[model samples]
Target: MPDFQKIPSNDVIDTLLKRVSVRKFTDEQISDETLDLILKTSFRAPTSSNIQAYSVVVVRDQEKLDALAAASGGQRHVAQAPVFLAFCADISRIEDALVRNGHSIDSNNLETGLVSAIDAALVGMSAYLVADSLGIKGVMIGGARNKPHEVAHILGLPQRVFCVFGMSLGWPAEAPAQKPRMDYDGLVHFEQYGKSRSGADAKKVVDDYDVALAEHYRGQGRQTTDASWSDDMDKKFHPWLRDDLRERLKELGFDFR
Candidate 1:
């Protein structure tokens, strides 16, 4: 068994620690009040220069949710969730404001892209925490980028706005096992970068986690073929990954020049 440490915080952590990416959800409907609170909390997230160059489109309509699920590689949980939110890196709103004030807005600027993406990420993280606090289970859908152009069309997003990602939210029907992560020693380095430990030390740390994970799954009667973390990493880090985000963003009127 791999040695584990507990979180030090005792402040009513609002069940955030209990959060896991829930792929399965109950049919329970999340109240509009709860949804509003989640969105409000997300908007409160800190942004670069307070530009807030991001927007979220909440999809409650069943047909739209189904379309999103299809776009997301047929992930059924997307349609199953009571709420689906598409978080966008939006510069159009800022550009409009600037233009109205007689300021020339260059939509092609890389700095604008960076600010929007960063703001969206911060807001997404905030939404995740807020939903978790409200006893809502959610999963971040990076797969939303699979067909970014189609997703943008479906969401009616304006030019200079791109879907950063999506989130499926609802109450979990069953508790999911906590996924194991790399050890602190493996991930953290001192002030300066430490010597490469990806040889035996890395293997040992991952091997320990593999055993723990496999055992945990086995106890739940789930059969896992991969016995080591390296095996899982190999599956995840494929070189021929299909990400057409650059082209799609360009098509959606983002000048990535």
Candidate 2:
């Protein structure tokens, strides 16, 4: 049972706690004014060194949306959503500034990639939350990385820019139950990481979460084996995500070597 007394009544916390990735949406189009507001709010998200090295391409054309849906592993929600935003980690602009100033980046390093991607992610989360405040809901499509070259071709992205991910947005048709997350005790370590991940403590938390999530799934009539969270984790790492991402990045002029 949850302790209602401990739950804060702040509106922001309430919105975040209830937030779920909404896949189904109504036909109503989001107004331009509202979209602008969301954009402004999302831009307020902090960027690394204030470089703000990210770009969001607002796509609404039906043909382009359909193509994006196909690129994103045939996700029908991407095609049907009122809007799709392709968030790209862009350093091309910075590269140009460097050339004019007689200095150059030392072949794209890990830190370059990290900062740009982080910039896009911060903005994306802020956008999602702000949009949710206006009753808009959406899902982030990480499948955009499945064919990064194709996505770039479709979006007309320049060099030093790549899609970190895409998002499909609209007014939701109905609310979906929020999914369970890992326990705070297991996730939050004291002074250093992995200190809390002892054999006994890790198993205890994972086992407890497995039972809780299994019960949650059963309540929703989802068929699966016992202790499903571990099974889910196994499946996640077995195939790995976008194994070709490194090659694709190098091809796009990013020397992550």
Whole-model lDDT per candidate: 0.82, 0.89
Candidate 2 per-residue lDDT, tens place, 82-133, comes to 9999989999888988999998864878888889999999999999999998
Mark the 10 consecutive residues where model 2 has the least summed lDDT.
192-201
Clashing pairs in 1: none
Q: TM-scores of all models?
A: 0.84, 0.92
Candidate with best TM-score:
2
The predictions' CA RMSDs to the true structure, in order, are: 4.6, 3.5
Q: Lowest-lDDT window of 10 residues in candidate 1?
A: 2-11
Residue 80 in model 1: lDDT: 92
What shift in Å separates residue 231 of candidate 2 from its native position after superposition?
Answer: 1.6
Error of 2 at 18 (Å): 0.9
